[model samples]
Target: MRNSIKSVFAAIVLSIGLFPLAHADDALDASKLYKAGQLNEAIKKIDAVLAQRPKDAQMRFLKGIILTEQNKPAEAITIFSKLTDDYPELPEPYNNLAVLYASNGQYLKASAALEMAIRTNPTYGTAHENLGDVYAKLASQSYDKALQLDSANSTAKLKLNLVKNLIGNTTGGTNPKTNTSNPAPIASIPNTAMVATPPAKVIEPKPVTPTVTKSTAAINEKDNVLDVVESWAKAWSNQNVSKYLAFYAKDFQTPNGESRNTWSEDRRSRIEGKGKINVRIDAPNISIDSNVATVKFKQFYTSDRLSSTSRKTLVLSKQDGKWLIKQERSGN
Candidate 1:
C-alpha cells in the first residue's frame, strides 16, 4: 500500500510539474535534484531556500517530501503537521500528512487527516481515493479484533481473510518495513503558467435585472442553525450529555430507529464511558428550505482508545424560534 501510494504521487508530480516558479532558479534546481534521486542535494537546496524565506510553504512542503524519501517519517510528519496548521486552507499538506500516518500504520489518524484534506478541497480526487484505502485498513483492523474475541466465529474469520487479501493485493504482499521504495512524490504544489492572449473587440453592455438575495431573517436562521450544530459538537466533546441531548428536537429521528429516550441513554453511556473525547465538524455545507435545513460535514472524532472520521448529515428544523436537530445520518 505504501509503495502504491508512492508510485501514484510520483506520477502526479511528473504529470503536473512542480511549484510555480516564483523563485524559478532555486525551486527548479531543487525539483531537478529531487527527480534525480539526489535526496541529500535536494534537501540542502531546499534548506538554503528556507533559510532565506523561512515561511515558504512550497519549500517546506518539498523538504517534507525529501525527508520522507530519506526514511525520516517523524521529521516529515512534523513538517506536514506544521504546514497544515499554518495553511489550513491548503488540502495538500493534510493529504501528505495522511500518507505519512498510513505509512506508519496509523490508519485512524490518517483517516482524520484525509477528512481535513477533503474538507479543504472537496474536488481533490487524490485525497478522496486515499481516504478509501485508509478506511479499508481500518475495517481490516476491526475484523481482526472481532476474530480475536471469537476465534470460533467463521463469519469473522472469513471477513478477516477477505480484508487481508484486499490489503495484500494493493501492497504487493510486501511488508511495509522491508519495502524500501522511494517515498511518494508530493504533487500538492500549485502549477502556474503564463499565456498570451489576443485583444478582443469592444462590446456593448446590456442592463441586467437585479439578482435575488437571501433575506436577513433567512441568513440569521442559517447562522442559528450552524450555532446549534457547533454547540452540539462542543457538548459532546465536553461530555455534557444533557446539553447534547437538548440540541435534538422532541421528535428527533434516531439513526437506528430506536426510541428517542433509548437513543439518548445509549449516547450518554458512550459519551461518559470515554476517558476523553473530541468532536469536530469541518467544511459544513448547509442548505435551507422553508423551516428545515440540511447540513453535511466531515465529522472527526477522537478519544483515548479510538479515533475516526466520517461524513455526517444532520436535518435541522426551526422549533419555537430555535434550530434543533430533527434527524441525523452518516454518509451522504
Candidate 2:
C-alpha cells in the first residue's frame, strides 16, 4: 500500500507546474529549503511570505505541498480544498487534494477530487491516472464487502485475492501499513523561466531564398482547426444554438449513446437555459493526423449562477473543406 501511495504521489508531482509569482525571490528561497529536506524551514519561509501576501496563490500552493511532506495530511487537505474554491481555474490544488484523500483511505473523495482536476484540465494526465487507481481501490472494497456477505462464495474469494495481488504488485509487494512515516518528495514547481541569461549577440543580416517546408501544410491545418474551435466556442457563448450545433459533423458521436435528436434537445435546454454565458479557451494543444484533428484546452465557462473551468477535447474532421466536431469529451 505504501508503494502504491508513493507511486500516486509521484504522478501528482510530475503533472503540476508552478505558476510564476511576483515575489520570486522569496518563493525560490522556500523552494530551495524544501528541496534540501528542511521541511520545517521551508514551511516557516512560506508562512512568512504568505503573511505578507495572504492572497498569494503560488505561496499557498507551496505551503500545501510542504504540509503534505510533513505528513500533516489534514492540514494539507484544508489548504488544497480552499485553493480549489478560490481558484477554480487551476487544477493542481484539486490534484493535491486527491492525493491527500487517497492517503487517508478516502478513495471516494479522492476520486471526486481527481475528477474535478481532470475537469479543470482534461489533459492533466496525472489526475486521470490517479482516478484509475481510486476506482481499483473502490472495486477492492466492493469485493471485500461481498465476501463478508457471503463467506462461502468462491468467486468473491477469488476476486478478493486477485485484487489484493494487483494492489500488492502496484506497491512492489510492500505491505501498505508498514511505510507510513516517510512520504514521497513532491516535484518542485519550476518558475516559468528557470534561469535567465544575457541576450544573444546580434549578427549581420544575410539574404537567403525562402523555402517551403513539409510542415507548412500541417501548420496551416492546425490553424484552421483552431479557428473552427474558437468559432464554436464563440457560438456557444453567444447562445447561437443553431450555429453551435452546425459545428458538429453529421456523424458526430452522441454522448452516452443518446440519439442525435435527443442529444441536440439536451444541448438546447442547457444552453438556452442559461441567462447569459461566457466561454474562453486557454493554452490549446492541437494535433492533426490526415483529415482528423484533436484539440485539448482549458475551458473557462461562466453564467449568471455558475462558473467553472474544465478541460475539453474535441475531435474535428475535415468535411467539405470545413472542420466539424466528430466527437467531444470532457477529459483526455
Candidate 3:
C-alpha cells in the first residue's frame, strides 16, 4: 500500500514536470483573476508570457480564456482565432472560439468552429456536447448527436425532449444511443478547461508579401523649409520644367515680397538661356490639421555661371476632397 502511494506521487510529479505545470498554474491564476473581475491585471500576466515566447499557442489560448471569462469574448475570439491559425491541428481553440461566437450571437460562426473542432478531434467530448448545443438551437435539427455522443446523457436527453415537444417530432421515444455508432467514452464533460493554446506552427512556402508603404504625416505644414533653387538640376535632368514649377503655386510671391513672383516664366527663360541648372529640395516638414496642410522644405539650386537657392513653404487646402496648393512662399 505504501509503495503504491509513493508510486502515485512519483507519477504525479513526473506529469507535472513533463507538461509545463508552472505555466499552467499561471494560466489558471490569470483565469481566476479574470473571474474575480481583475481583467487588466490578468491581461498583464498573460502578456508577460506572450512577451517571453510570442509563438506559444497555449499561452495565447490561456489569454483568450482569461479574456472570455472577463466578458470580453470578442477579444477572446480574436485570440483563439490566432491560436487556430497557428496550430490548425489543435482542436481546443476551435471549440473554445465556437463558444465565444455563440456568446456573441454568431451562431453560424459557432457551428463552423464546432465543425472544425470535431474534425480535428472527434474524440473531444466537450466539442461534441457543444456541437449538440449548437444544433439544438438551429431550429429543427435532429438531436441525433446528443444521443449519439452520450446515449445516456441526461442533459442531452432532457434538452432533446424539450426540443421535440416544441417541434412535434415524436418518434415513439426511440433510444438512438443503442444504434451501432462508434462508442465514445461515456464520460461527458463540457469544455471548461482553461486553454493555453498550442504554439504557432511555421507554415511552409510562405508567399512573399510586399512591404506596406506609409504616407509621412506633417504636423503643421512648414517645419522643414525646402531648397527650391537646387531642384532645378534634377528638374532639368528629368526635363520637367512644368513639374518643378507646379510644386510652387503659379502666383507665388518673390523673396523681395513682390506678388506673382518666383519661378515666373520670365525667371525660367532667364535661367535656361544663361546656363545649366541643378536643384534639390530636402528636409521637408509638413503638418495637416482639419482641412488645411502646411509644408516647408529647403531648396538648393546650382548653376555653371551662377547659383541661387531659397527656402519655401507651401500651404495646401483639401477643398472638395482634393488637396490643392493654396499659398506658396520662398520664406519670410
TM-score, per-candidate, Cα-based? 0.53, 0.53, 0.37
Model 1, range 94-169, lDDT digits (tens) per residue? 8778777887788789889988877555678777766877777777778778878988989977877776665554
Better of 1 and 3 by TM-score: 1
Segments of candidate 1 deviating more than 4 angstroms: 2-22, 169-287, 290-332
Query: TM-score rank, highest first?
Result: 2, 1, 3
lDDT of 2: 0.71
Scored by CA lDDT, what does every candidate get?
A: 0.71, 0.71, 0.54
Q: Worst 10-residue stretch by lDDT in candidate 1? A: 190-199
lDDT of each residue in 1-332, candidate 2, tens digit only: 52243222222223333344345677667666766768799888888877887767767777787677666878988888887765665677887787778777788888888877775666777667667767777887787788789889899779878777655433222222322234333344322101112225558799998676878877878878888887788678768899999999999998898999999999999999687686878889999988889999999998889899999999999999999999999965
lDDT of 3: 0.54
- Give the better candidate number (1 or 3) by lDDT: 1
Give the Cα error of residue 5 in candidate 1, in Å: 4.0
Model 2 lDDT at residue 76: 82
